[model samples]
Target: MRIPIGRFTVPPEQPVVEEKTPSPSDKEAGVVSEQHPSDHESDNDAISSDAQAGVKKIEATTKVWSKSHLIAAYIGIWIIYFVDAMQQGTGTLLTPYVTSSFQEHSLTATTSVFSSLIGGISKLTLAKILDIWGRPQGYMITVLLMTVGLIMMAACQNVQTYAAAQVFYWVGYNGISYTLSVFIADTSSLKNRGFMLAFVSSPYIATVWITGPMAQSLLQGIGFRWGFGIFSIITPIMCLPLFFLFTYNYQKAKKQGLVVIEKSGRTFWQSVVHYFWEFDVICLILLSGGFALFLLPFSIYSYQAYGWRDPLTICLIIFGGLLLIGAFVWEAYFAPVQFLPWSLLRDRTVMGACCLAAILFVEYYIWNSYFTSWLQVVLNLNVTQTGYVSNIYSIGSCFFSFFVGIAIRWTGRFKWIAVYFGVPLTILSIGLLIHFRQPDTHLGYIIMCEIFYAFAGGALVICEQIAVMAAAAHQHVAVVLAMEGMFSSVGGAIGSSIAAGIWTGVFPVKLAEYLPAESQGDLASIYGDINVQLSYPIGSPTRTAIMDAYGEAQKWMLVGATAITGLAIICVVAWRDIKVKDFKQVKGLVA
Candidate 1:
């Protein structure tokens, strides 16, 4: 009987005529079906086993880098950072020689132009080069640029020639600095990024501190050619290991198909535009601008205006640099961004942070470039001892940076920190500088002032970074950072130029005024040996008396710092009461 189920009824006689099934040996042999629960269970087990085996194979075949490799990468980054420091530190030593040999400050300006070109211009151009050519090639190219620059510097006789050399030097400098940062970011996980970053920074600090005195010693003893030549040789040797490191990384990336750009799309314009819209690019510009602005008066004026011959100036600059770096990270991670669809700089908090950073950096630069030089020029400290004493700023900055980080974490608001610690210390630093007029004033007082300034500067740096980041929504952090750098650089360049103009303009007029009218023209010859003013026995009384006339120039620097910092306070005030925006809700606007 047939059983009927639903729509159609089964016919009772449908299977009455049964046909014979085909034999197994036949071409159309029938297949057998296994219906046992055990067969299904066994098949499932086999599939699971195959998956586990695949996972095991992956675990076993995947290469985990050795500790030695990790250490090598770390050290390699450190060396890259170290080279940039050495360039700056050694350049500080070479400045006097370059100025004297060229007999023109304009040549020095040319060198500055070259330096800026490599740093700002090249960074824009090379970003794409890195993407297309890969990081290894970019790194190697940078090493070559640096090597060529140093070699040219060693061989320079004229100002133009030396300035030309700076182009190459700066190219190398920007290349390595930018590429290494990219490499680190690519290789490290987010959790350990902070430590790795710190590892890179530590070398910068350590090298800067040591390079100054060492560079100075080399300049004084073996002369500039050999001193700078050594760097040329060392740069390539130091970069050799990087060749292997970068190659390994590139090969790995190739295998993974991680390279984004191809050689066909490579062009200077394309490279620049590639990074223009990137968040990190903006951040780099902003931070660099802040740094540049801070550096302006000091970098341009210290050697010429105050006749500073101390290495400590550089050390102090690095102190602030390291502190601000930490502050930047905290800000970028924690702060919000504004104008999410466009720019990152419109955020008030970030603007305030930039302002404060600008203030502190400018103040620090003044001391680094001018005060120490004034101490030696006006107070007459010997070179050896003065270099050691320059560490006062470093001592103060290092101590305070640690404290400021804690203060921000403890207190949610950054306003009080800016007002209470930031502005007051900056004002007081200027005050201390103004009062530091007496030739016989104790060095201890100066050191104390520097310490105080460093403390204040540290607080300001942290506050500004936090505020700026807070001001912007999260998506624009990198853009804000780049803007900060660009502004800082412009500010610094202008400040330094002003300082140079002031010194070159003032010193000669004062010297001329104190000299006899007939001897005024002849006194110009004595400018190369400005120490003659301190030691009348070495030259003439007219130069000494003329130098004495400008005993008040040092005090003017204090007034300038005070004025700049006052402007900074106004920026700080403007920065207050701004609300930070949340970026997560606007993620589509970000990219």
Candidate 2:
């Protein structure tokens, strides 16, 4: 999906290449060979047929459009991104409130765990769909899922139903993000890829500031339900143009013989069976189920009447572990087609990128999952004030990443910057947070910590993204990138689970320990809603107890986050230092 630099003009007619999977009989049995062509194979080495098709597909789809089409596509993509970003920003504001209504505020992170698991994994599935059905089909499917989830969220009657809706929304959310990311990767050369990647997320800079106030107003006026309902209509509308452009261009590519369809002659049912095997559906199911079961316990086990002693909790955790093991065994020994490109599994740079992203996400989510509530309750901030403080990490990340992207463009490098600044900043942020996240700390101090973490988080995210993509050629971009996103999101799921375990387990105990003896009877109410905690005046016994409880519970989570982030440095050092100099050099990956 390479476009001409600056102009984005369509390429010349390409040769027809039939789409199909690599055969088990051949060495390139998966979607890609286990070794990179440049790494192990000489220039004269014969490329496999499936590799040729893949390469050709990438070339053909690099098809761009006229000036007007380009403008429309560029605008459409950004607009859709803006709408989605706005929706998410507001949704985050409302989720705690929704949980409070159900008297399940403590379960907020638990709900997010399910969503992150589903959404993160959906990237792998969407990548496969893009490979088989084309980009437009995958994009439209995600849009549909997103709209349905939005509608369900507005209408959901209970926490269980809302959790299901959250899962649906997250799947679509990850899918949309994945599609947009692939779009950027498909169009830009490696030299400018870093900048482009950061540029797209620039919407967050504005949305972050606006969403809090906007959501606050909406909550006061029409309510959270209407907010979700309005967005359900708006997001899909913004998506229409991009969907049309991809579909139109794809059909035109097909007509020009630049894109060839598979001609496997089989009945419809047989074809379905073939794709099931080709996609390794059973493997995906096992993987998803394993993660869901294993992670669910950490988030929900404390809520059970029997707690950790519950037989159901023990069985679920054991079965989940077994299922995960089964998935690994299957992927390693028996799957016909692997989810990630085979060579990606062997690429040190790619693995390092995935590991780095996973580590960052794990650390970020562990402390961040319940951070807003912490700010509101402990600092005595309103919803809008909490939003202002909460947005600093993300806004700063986007703000810093844009400049870092430009730095990457000029330097033709990223690894050194990440090691020197990103890692150190992360360590510093944690160190500051240890002090600032305490009871009655000045609000400015907390913001300072967030700013540091924001820079570290953004830099690491951009570096890993560029590192992973730079290691792969055009043909393997979607698969490798999807794998990275999958790992990152899975890490987030794990972090959310840990946070849930800590917050639910430690927070209530702390509350019980610190609250006045007479107030013990109201423990459940205070534990479930920050609003109730906020009702008591500052410096009062009850308020003091609440603040002390919040501080003690989160102190351990911050320490754990900092401890986990140390692994990020190892990931940075392990990467293969590839310089992005020109699109033609090393097929636009390495200089």
Candidate 3:
């Protein structure tokens, strides 16, 4: 019907033309009524369908890398891990040799402090590097640093040189590990990520058994130089394939216009300035330095003339505490980019996972720091025997970690495994170890404790990784993972320091009390030289006294670890149950 308009003519209403449905023959000829009431709605429907199809096409293009590429990438990362495991296995055995060569038993604790501090710092640094420059660049830099560090260690002639070499090696080791973790997170779907990570760690199984015997042979027969030198060459070779694969894929993506590399269009110096600001170097310094200075005193107190009363120690503690406070403030309020995002603290899953990891490492290191020496002194085992015994824990860890990965994939739940299996088994193992930590305890019982502890500990590791990743946004995975690593490293440092303090303080005093009057004056020599202690005849009073003293110290350490493990169970229970989503689902949601 026609109606009167503001300025035009008013016309009488005419009979309305009703639209008729098209016949089948007319529909086949693409006929449509011009007067259809829903003409605009039909056009909108067609546009919506086209848009949905376009999204699907884009997703398919973005996910173009083949399964074979993923498999090759996994293998390449596994090779890097294998090399790292070899270093770890041999490094444990090298401690005594390094100490003896330097004529200082305290070097052991000092080196650990340096390694942990550098390693923690490297994790934070590498996280930024990977996020900014991409994974291939980060991986290459880590391998290069590690190779250089190994060469330095192989050629070192003094404790100072060895300590410096350790700094380099540990930093690179942490970087490599962190980068590989991020790569796994990027490639695997949430449901299968646990298994992929565990598979990467499978190198620990073979390296644990082989590196021990190899370390023993090298240290006893030839020397530590070759031990360090051989792996230096192997690491770079293993890393090459992964580097190439990443570069190839990145370039391919760029060529396809699927990814854009952002340029700041600044001069070289300006770019450097931007990168420094982007990496938040000031916060990095504050955090890393604070941790190092504060924790270093624990390792060095025994060597100080005044122990904890030393002015230097007091200064370090105060300064470190202040720097840590500053770091928190800057991260929370000032830094453009935070090394630790305050936002993550709001996530119960991230916090719980981080806490669980920190607690576990603290307990693990408390016993680990002195375990080999304890085995040697209390059990009268040689290097090879000690390696074999110590590695039982690792053997169990490898087997159980792999099993937990499969279970998580099957059940699609990680928290239950941690609560039901990890916590109780770990606590039980520690309790048994504490109970049996006596001079006359059976070796079989000790081995059993290690086996049980490792099995549960391995599962806990898997749980933490899965939990943290599951809770994080895909873009923040690297940073969150690195944050977890930093916490765990800090925990290791704290545990090592405490263990050092206890062992160094108590063992010397106990040894002095138990030694015969005639031999009492040689406490310094006895403490410095494991070989000198072993020279005492078997079953002699001197040997028995030293063994008893070690037993006492080890018992206390186990007690501390047991208490920490109990607390970790609380964290395990508190972790949130977040469902893992498949890659396609995540992508769709993001789109």
Candidate 4:
């Protein structure tokens, strides 16, 4: 039965069909192979056992869809990914302008640290929700959140409200992206899985080109509010088809008894309590609380007049460190459920992939946090040009990532390719950035480095993504992928914190050091606003001074980014050699 909501009809909920225990002969004949989730918390197949049968049904029949039906499904997935990417890409470009409008531009990286932590946890929660309730239900929830975020952003009166809205936006964004990955995983065999993922993620290529132009139009035309408002309306509509398709197929599978939902054989209250323990609520709380306390100081310290010496900042840093320690202690000893299963923790490949993913974010954000601002201020580029130059990374990465996918399929080896090829190229590109990122270097040389880094980074992304997915059985892929993403998001937050810390601490001093004595009094105003820096005429004394100061900061940032990225190379080199040719997909179980 469809639930009507004004003009739209919600997809029919799955009809509850109680599972039956199979007889001895049925078991002997291989009529069912149901593996239960661990009784305790896990990153394995640890959703409620009742959801397993439904999920099993999805895994089983996904490969059995008629060719046309499969095409339609693929089409829906592509549409969902494309629209979401379009919105996220354009919106990300508009964010600094919005922050600048509130005259609190310093808070940009700080707020992202908060949001990434929220988004990380939210990714895991939604993965669980989608795995249990059904994809459409999760999709609806995410879309609702994203729409709310967009609407709030459009209506926001201050920096605080806008930051609050970003949390919801990230949740929905991560959820939708997660769904897209799972959708591809559900359909593809290991043989072409890498290729399939790349094909679906191709939207980034378009968004790189399109969002720059679109953001420029919105920035110079009506305004960011209109842009946000328009996306609030369009995003949910664009997502409807994909979730509808997934729901229809899943419900159809259930109706035909292709699979069955199991009874947990527990009372309502017991099951509720069971899930709380099973989802590792305590662990999540500790992790979030601890990381927030630990990470926020990096960005917020500058806000305090006393800076690092402020009692509040010092207290928060200490408290945050203690909480992080508490989280580890709880996970290791007192918790019934834990964030990562010990088995996964022991898997070198998975850990290596996780580390590589995390470090990449740290590396990227170290320099990336302010490169666009550098472009506009030092290079005298406008918003559109700044956006275009910035997107050279996205453009090359997305396009060549598609190539990496096919290369992985053809070469049938990921570990060595990343270690030997992706790693070295990425290192070279970043090394080039150290020299060319300065104001004296021509812009074309800088673009070339970004392109080179993008190509290598693209390959590295696919390698790490597929490596994690390959390590886990299909049944656990959602959680595993979510976990890797969690690592990345947290790493990104930390990276943002480090960058923000360096920027806030160093940029002001550099500004003061470089400016003439007569201009010393204007240093605070100049440091606080990018607009003020850009207002100085090109080649003028003030502009030239700002360039030299900014170039100094950029030099240090790029050095830090380069040093951090070397860790990713170590991760790749230490990765267990898993070849695509040797992979097996049996009943969604990895081999």
Q: Which candidate number would show the highest lDDT if scored against the true structure? A: 2
Deviation from native of the Cα of residue 5 in model 2, angstroms = 3.6
Best by TM-score: 2
What digit string (tens of lDDT, one per residue) describes model 3 on residues 39-117?
Answer: 2233221111111121222222224455566667777788888888888788788877777677776456667775776
Q: What TM-score quantifies how close candidate 2 is to the native fold? A: 0.92
Q: Lowest lDDT 10-mer window, candidate 1?
A: 582-591
The TM-scores of all predictions, comma-separated, are 0.63, 0.92, 0.86, 0.88
Evaluate all candidate structures by whole-model CA lDDT and list the values in order.
0.50, 0.78, 0.72, 0.73
Model 1 spans > 4 angstroms off = 1-72, 104-145, 167-199, 203-209, 239-247, 253-342, 355-373, 390-419, 437-440, 459-480, 516-521, 528-550, 572-591
Query: By the TM-score metric, which is better: model 1 or model 3?
Result: 3
lDDT of 3: 0.72
Clashing pairs in 4: none
lDDT of 4 by residue, 1-591 (tens): 111111112222233443332111111101011121121124332222333433454553452344556667666777777888778878877877787887766666776787778777667666666555555676789888888989999999988889888888887787777777776766666657777777777777777778878888998898999999998999988888777776676666666555556765777777677668756778788788889898888888877979999999999989988988998899788877556555554567777898888888887888888887888888888777877888887778878887887787788778877988888888889888999988888999998899889899889988998887766665566666777888888888888898888888777778888887777888877776777778889888888888998898888888988888888877887766666553434232210
Order of quality (lDDT): 2, 4, 3, 1
- Per-residue lDDT for 212 in model 3? 69
RMSD vs true structure, all candidates: 19.4, 3.7, 14.9, 7.3
How accurate locally is residue 38 in candidate 3, as Cα lDDT from 0 to 100?
26
lDDT of 2 by residue, 1-591 (tens): 222345333334544455454222112422222233443343321222334443444345445344455545656776777888889988988888888878889988888887887788778778777655556677888999999999999998888999999988988888988887777776666677777777678788888888889788887999889989999999888898898886676566578676667765666777677778767788888888999999888887878889888998898899999999998889878887765455566777888899888888888889988888888888887778778888887689988998898899899888888989999899889877977899968878888888998988888889998888777765567777789989988999999999999998899999999999988999999999866887889988999999998898789899999999988889999887777664331221110
- Candidate 2, after superposition: displacement of residue 211 in Å? 0.9
